[model samples]
Structure formats: structure tokens, C-alpha cells
Target: MRTQVCIIGGGPSGLLLSQLLDRAGIDTVVLERRSRDYVLSRIRAGVLESGTVGMLEKAGIATRAHAEGLPHTGTYLAVQNTGFRIDFDALIGKQVLVYGQTEVTRDLYDAREKADGIVVHELDGVELHDLDTDAPHVTYVKDGTTHRIDCDYVAGCDGFHGPSRQAIPKDVLTEYERVYPFGWLGVMADLPPVSHELIYANHPRGFALASMRSPTRSRYYIQAPVDDPLDKWTDDAFWDEFRRRLPHDSAEALITGPTIEKSIAPLRSYVADPMKWGRLFLVGDAAHIVPPTGAKGLNLAVSDVHYLFEALTSHYRDGDDHGIETYSQTALKRVWNAIRFSWWFTTTMHRFPGQEPFDQAIQDSELRNLQTSVNAQTVFSENYVGMPY
Candidate 1:
């Protein structure tokens, strides 16, 4: 099948891109290797920048989000050695909404299913073949036979390890990477959140985060070595660590529920420059990845789609390729800005491997400054709440 755009991956970026393009009268196809159920049930990002909500609103997909999502004025920063609360809203007037990526994806998926000229092929298990030529196509196995899809342009939203990056000539790409010594162990509980706002704590033991997914479900994370086996920590052990890091006036207020999910995801920052080659372009995690401390992953993907859609719109209107021609450079500016912020937040909060005494002192001093200095807080707020869209 031939189309204006062939999107590889049905995650937020690919699905959202197709939705935006469809609204603008562009033809797009979305291919996903997983079943529709898997994408709908995936527990991914839970925070959405204010700007992201606006994008979903504009796209007419905010009905369920508006009804079910929780709105928070800001977050809290606590130092375990000494209990402290640094308000993010006081630092910046903006606030973020707590909504699951699954919700947004489900909405977009449904919208795509209903929109004309938009084809969402689930369970296609598409494989990337040749991308060096002007014409790029995806070959996938369907009904026990191979099929080919042709399009005017290909978008690699599959993710970091996906085929899109492999297609790029190795010599032409420059990669910058930093792997953190620790990974985040996230858990979800069925109890109500202890605090209305999110709390991030820095303690001698390690770093911990207090966040909520809904009024009834709370999500929290603590720092652990990348090599640490999750089996070492049981449900009670997890709660003990959480209680030590997150101190509340009343221990009764602490949210408690069945230990639902546990996993260790390493923290890292990665960036690939010039996200386009020939008729193929990359967006979202496929082009860049952040540590998630700044809550920018899902938001960045939304921004990427905005720039991509604007570029495509300009390309079609008045025959000006200005937007498409400059897509990489334009998106990179925002991508790099987020990368820096995520790195700063992640490194500042989490302990490094074999951190020397001096290095630990420097990190402590920096955190103290962030708490006491208005200037430092302002910088954090801008990136935390999000930069102007």
C-alpha cells in the first residue's frame, strides 16, 4: 500500500503523528508489532506536561483525559537528612497533569481507527529492509506471507533499538551517551496518595520519588544499583525503604496497598543528531532519550509531533519545504535542551557509582543551593514544568 507517510510503531509518537497528519488532510499508516491489547495495557509514563494536554485538546482527544486525569499544581522536593519541601509552582506558575500514557494512546488509537484514510495495522510484525534509496518500504509477515508497504516518507518512531536508526549510515551519525550507575525501581500500589503533590527526596541512603497515578493508585520509585537484583527486595522490604525515604507527619497517611508491579529500568541519556536521511525521518525515543527525571519523555514526544506536523503542513501549503527541510535542526534544539535538563536532574538526585567523598559533597552542595537559591529554583522550574512550547 502507498501513502504519504508510513509510521513504524504505534506508540504515542507514531499514533499521535498519524492523528495530527490525518486532521490536516494527510494520509498516514501506523504499523505495530504488538497486539492492540498490549499497547492499551502498557504502564508507561504517568505525567503529562500542561502543554501536552493542550495538544491533545486541540486534537479533540481530551474527553477521557479531562474526566479521569488528576491535575496537580506542582511537586515537592525533600531532603531525607532534613525534611524539606520545595514547591515547584512557587518557583514557576505552571502545573502538570497526571495521566497515563496508555490513556492517551488508547484515545489516539481509537481516533485513528475511525478517521478516514488512516490505517492502523496491529500485529503486523513489520521488519525494515532497505532505506538507502529514494523509496523505502517495510516488509512484514501477515497471514503467513510477506507483504510490502510503500510510502512517500517513512517515520521511525519504533524506538532506540528499532530499525530506523540502523538504516542510517553509521559513518554519518554521531552518538552521545551516559549510562547511570543506578536504575529506578518503580512500584504501584492501590492506596490513595499521601500527598496531593509529587515529592522527590534526596537522602544519604539514596534517591526516592513519591508520585501518584490516580486518587486511588499511588506510584513511587527508589534508586537502586543497575546490577541489583529485584528479588532481593520483597513487598515489605520495598515499603520499608519507601517509608524511610518518604517521611510524613503521620505514618498513617502513607499510601499503602498491594504491591502491584516492580521493575528496574536503568537511567541514561542518548541523542542521535540530524534525525532525517533521504525520505526517512525519526521522531521521539527513536531520535533521542532522556532519563525521565524531568518528566519530559512523553512531553518531548508530543513536541516532536508538533514540529513534524508543522513541517509537513508547510511543505504541503504553498509548496514550501521550509518546515520539512529544517525539521531535524529545529527539533534537536528542543531535544537537546530536554536532554540537558534530564541529565542534570538525574545526576544531581541519584548517587553515582563509587562516588568519592569530594564528589558526594559537591552533589550535596548543589542540592542545598537548589533549595535555597531562587535563581537555581527558577532554572529547575522552567525545565520541570516544561519550557514554552
Candidate 2:
């Protein structure tokens, strides 16, 4: 097979890039190691930053999301039993859309299929070859057969564990990572949310987040030990702990129901510098990952897509190499900013194992500053709505 670009992942980042390129009259192909069902089955963060929402619109896939997704003008932050709101719209005239990542992927998939875009799923042992040369290609095995795609460039959207990043020579790559000592025990329930907007709470026990996928579907999480077992957390036990972390009013108003899905996700901040190397460019999770505290995991990925899509389009349409040449430096600038925000938010909200009293005082003062200072709230709102792409 021959194409202009070979995208090595069929998730939102890969699909979104392919969709945009296809609409731009550029030929591309997407390869996925898992079946479509398995890809969509994973539940992820739902908060959509403004940049991502705009990217969906540019790809002509935002109609469904705009129709079904909820819009939040602000979020709530609580210290112990006292809660305060940060009005994003009031601070920055912007609001984030509460749309599930699953729905976004579904929309991208539908768009790709409708346009007859090439997407190969369940391909194993995917490999990249001659990435540093003028001619680049990708190979994979499918159904006992081997296939190869010759393309002008390769997009590594295959995520953190995928082959794309590994293809980069070890000497050229520098990786930085921090694994938190705790994890988030999240539960998805078929009940109304505890609040209309999301609430991030810092309690004596740990950190708890009250969020939702929609008006009638609630998604909640509480911090737990890193090695906590899923089986040990029953539905009743999760609710008991969740309520105790919320303010008295919110706790009394909370509704409990059977959980549809539950899992523990460890927090981490990871970044692989230089997102691009020769004809290969790493986008999304392949390049960096942020803790979900600031709801930046998918947003950061989409931002990468935004930068890469622009660079690729310019290269193909106008014969411009400037964007491609500086893609890594440009993307990392924003990536580092987001990494800092997620790290700061996570540290402030969660209790560390050996946290000192001074550490607690610092966290308290930060939250108090956010509540009282317009500048602090504006900064939070700006980062929350997303820094400009």
C-alpha cells in the first residue's frame, strides 16, 4: 500500500488526524492492534477542552457531541467541608464541554468510515522502517499475512506502550516520568450526578472527584493506595467513602446506584522529549501523559494532533517544511505547561504518604489563594478551559 501518511493507531488522535487529512484531500491509512469493540470499551476522561472541541468541529465531527454533550461553565473545589466555585466563563468567557471520550472516538470512527478512509484493525507486530530516510514505511501482520505501507511520513499515535516510540533510537530519546504513590478508584453509575458541575475535593483521607458523563450518568473517584485491589472495593464501600469526602450538603444530596464500571487508575506524569524524529512524529499518548487531575490526558493528546495536523497539512498542501521542522519544539512548549498544571493540581489535592504539616499548610494556602484572588482563579480558569493551542 502507498499513502501520504501512515497513522499507527486508530484511537481518537489517529482517527482525528486521518479524518482531517482525508478532508484536506491527503491520502492516509490508520492501523490498530485491537478490535474496534475493544478500543471503544475503555472508559476515559470526558472533559473536553476548547481546543479539542474546535478540532472536532474542524474535522466536521462535532455535531453529535454538541447535541449530546453537557457544557460546564465552571467547576467546584473543596477543602475539607468548605467548597468554592471557579467560574471559567466569568473569568475567561469560555466553558468546557462534558463529552465522553468514547463518544468522541465513536464520532471520529463514523466519520472515517463514511468518507471511506483506510483503517486496519487487529494488526499485530506493527513495525516502522527507515524512518530517518526520505522513504518511510510501516509493516504489520494480520490474519497470518504480512503487509507493508509505504508513506511519506509516519504518525505514532499508538500510545505509550505502542511500537512507535520504541522505534526511535534509544540514544535520541530522553524520557521523564513520575509515578504517584496512589491511584484513583473510579466508579461509573447510572444515576444523576451529585452536582451539576464537577467537584474536586481534598479531604483528610485523600482526594475525591465527583464528575459525570451526562445528566443521568455519574462518574466518581477517590484516591487510594497504589496497590489497592479492585475486588476489595464493593459498591457500598465506594459510596461510603465517596460521601464522607464531600461537603455535608453534597454528601446528603448524593444519590447511590449500581455501578456500571469500576477501576483503579494510577496517576503519573510522563513525557518523551522531541515528539518528532525524521519522518516519524509521535502524537498523543505516544509523546506524553498527564494525570487526570486536571482532565488533561486526552486534551493533551488532541493538542498534539492539532499541532501535527497543521504541520502535515502545510507540508503537503503548500510545500512548507517550517512547521514540520519545528513540530517537536513547538508541541513540547505546550506539553510541559500542561504537565506542570496537572502535577501541581494532583499534588495539591491528594495526600502524600509522608506529607509534613507544612505541606498541608501550603496546600491550604494555595486553595485559599485561588478562592480569594481573581488572578489565581483566572489562572486556574485559563488552564482549565485550556491554554491556547
Candidate 3:
């Protein structure tokens, strides 16, 4: 088989890129190791930066999101149970759309189907060859048959555990990572959110976040030991801890309900430099991962897609390779920025083991500055809503 671009993932990043490229007259095929059902079953955060919303718009799949997604102009930040709002719109003239990642993937898949785009599923032993050369190809097994796909370029959107990142020579790919001591214990319930806007709270007890998927579907999380087992946390236990960390008012307004889903996600900031290796480019989780505190995981991937799509378009249309030549460095610039922000936010909001009183005081001082200083709030608002493309 032959394609202009071989995208080695059927997830949102891969599908979005294929959709954008196909619309631009670039031929591509997507290969996924898992079935579509399995891919859509994974749950993820969905705080959409304004730029991601625009990308969805350009892909013609934002209609449902715009109609049903919640739009928040600002979010609330609390310290020691005293909370204040950071108005993103008032400060930066922007807002975030809260749409679930599952829904976004579904929409992208639907768009691809409508366009008759090719997406292969359930592949085994996927491999990339000759990525350092101008031409690269991919090989995989579907059923009992082995198949080969020759393409001008390869897009490694297959994520952290996938083969795309592993294909890069160890000597060439440099990785940086910081694993936090804590994780987010989250629950999904069929109840209304405690607050209209998202609330990020810091307390002596721990850190808690009040968020929602929709007006009726609440998503909540509280910081916990990274090694803590889910069986140790019953529904009531999670609610009690969550309420304890929230501001008194939001805690009072919080309603308890049966949890539909629950899990603990470890927090970490990871980035692999030089997102591009010859004819292969890494996208989304394949190249970088940000701690969820700043909600930059998927958004970073979208930015990479934007850069790669633009670069690929330039190459095909006007024979320009500037974007391609600079893709890795350009994407890493934004990647490192988000990494720093996530690290800062996570450290400020969570209680570290063996942290001295001086450390706690510093965290308090920073939150107080954000609460009291308009200039500080503006910076927070800008980073929270997104730094810009």
C-alpha cells in the first residue's frame, strides 16, 4: 500500500491530522493496534483551549461541541478554604470550552467516515523503517496477514506506549521526565457541579478540583498518594475528602451521588525533545505529556498537529520546507513552556511529602499573590486559557 502520509494511530490526534490533511488534498492512512471500540472506551480530560476549538472548527467537527459543551470565562482558585476567581475573559478576553475527549474522538471518527478516510484497526507488531531517509515505510500484521505501507512521511500519533516513539534511535531522542509523589483520585457522577466554573483548591488536607463534563454530569478529583489503591477509597470517602479541600461555600453546595466511574491518575511532566526525526514526526502523547493540573496534555498535541499540518501543507502546495525543518524545535518551545507551567501549578497546589513549613509558606505566598495581585492573575489567566499558538 502507498500513501503520502502514514499516520500510526486512530486516536484523536491522528484522526484530526488525517482529517485536516485529507481536506487539504493530502492522502493518508491511519493504523491502530486496538479496535475503535477500545480506543473510544478510554476516558480523558477535556478542557479545550480556544485554539483547539478553532482547530475543531476548521476540521468541521466542532458543531456538536459548540452546541453542547460548557463555556467558562474563568475558574476559581482557593487556598486554605478561601477562594477567588480568575476571570480569563476579563483578563485575556478568552474562555475554555469543556467538552469530553471521548466525544471529540467520536466526532473526529465520524468526520473521517463521512469523508471516506482510511483507518486500519487491530494491527500487531507495527514497525517503522528508514525514518532517517527521505522515504519511510511502516509494517504491521492484521489478522494473519503482514502488510506494508510505503509513504513519504510517517506520523507517530500512537501515544506513549506505541512503537512510534520507540522507533527513534536512543542516541538521538533525549527524554526528560518528573514523576510526582501524588495522583488524582477522580470520580464521575450524574450530579450537577459544585460550582458554575471549575474550582482548583489547595488545602492542608490536600488538593481538590471541582469540574464537570456537562451541567448534569460532574467530574471531581482530590490529590492522593500515587501508590494508593482504589479499593482504599469508597465513594463516601472520596466525597468527604473532596469536600474537605474545597472552599467552605462550594463544599456546602456540593451534592453527593452514586459514582459511575472512578480512577487514580498519576501526575507527571514528560517531554521528548526534537519531536521530528527525519521523515517521522511525533504528535501528542507520543512526544510529550504534561501533568493534568494545567490541562495541557491534549492541547499540546493539538498544537503539534497545527504545526505539522501547516508544515506538510506548505511542502505540498508551495514547496516550502521551513516549517518542516523547524517542526521539532518549534513544537518543543511550546512543549517546555507548558511543562514548566504544569510543574509550577502541581507543586503549588499539592502537599509534598516531607515538605518543610517554609515550603508551605511559599506556596501560600504564591497563591495569595495570585489572589491579591491583578498582574499575577493576568499571568495565570493567560496560561490557564492557553499561551497562544
Highest lDDT against the true fold, candidate = 2
Q: State the lDDT of candidate 1 residue by residue for 236-281, as single tens digits.
A: 8888887887755423468565778888888889999879877778
Worst 10 residues of 1 by lDDT: 116-125
Q: Model 2 misses residue 156 by how many Å?
A: 0.3
Residue 200 CA error for candidate 3 (Å)?
Answer: 0.4
List the pairs of residues colliding in candidate 1. none
Candidate 3, residue 264: how far the Cα is off, in Å: 0.9
lDDT agreement with native, every candidate: 0.80, 0.94, 0.92
TM-score of each: 0.94, 0.99, 0.99
- The TM-score obtained by model 3 is 0.99
lDDT of 2 at 204: 77
Model 3 CA lDDT for position 217 = 94
| Model 2 lDDT tens row, 1-389 | 99999999999999999999999999999999999999999899999999899999999999999999999999999998789999999999999999999999999999999999999999898999999999999999999899999999999999999999998999999999999999999999999999999999998789999999999999999999868888899999999999999977899999998999999988899999889998999999999999999899899999998998899899988999999999999999999999999999999999999998888888889999999999999999999889998
Model 2 ranges with Cα > 4 A deviation: none
Which tens-of-lDDT digit does each residue in 1-389 have in candidate 3? 99999999999999999999999999999999999999999989989999999999999899999999999999999998989998888888999999999999999999999999999998899999999997799999998899999999999999988999998889998999998888999899999999988999988878999999999999999999978989999998998899889999998999997999999999878899779898999999999888899688988899999999999999999999999999999998888888998899999999988988898899999999999899999988888888887
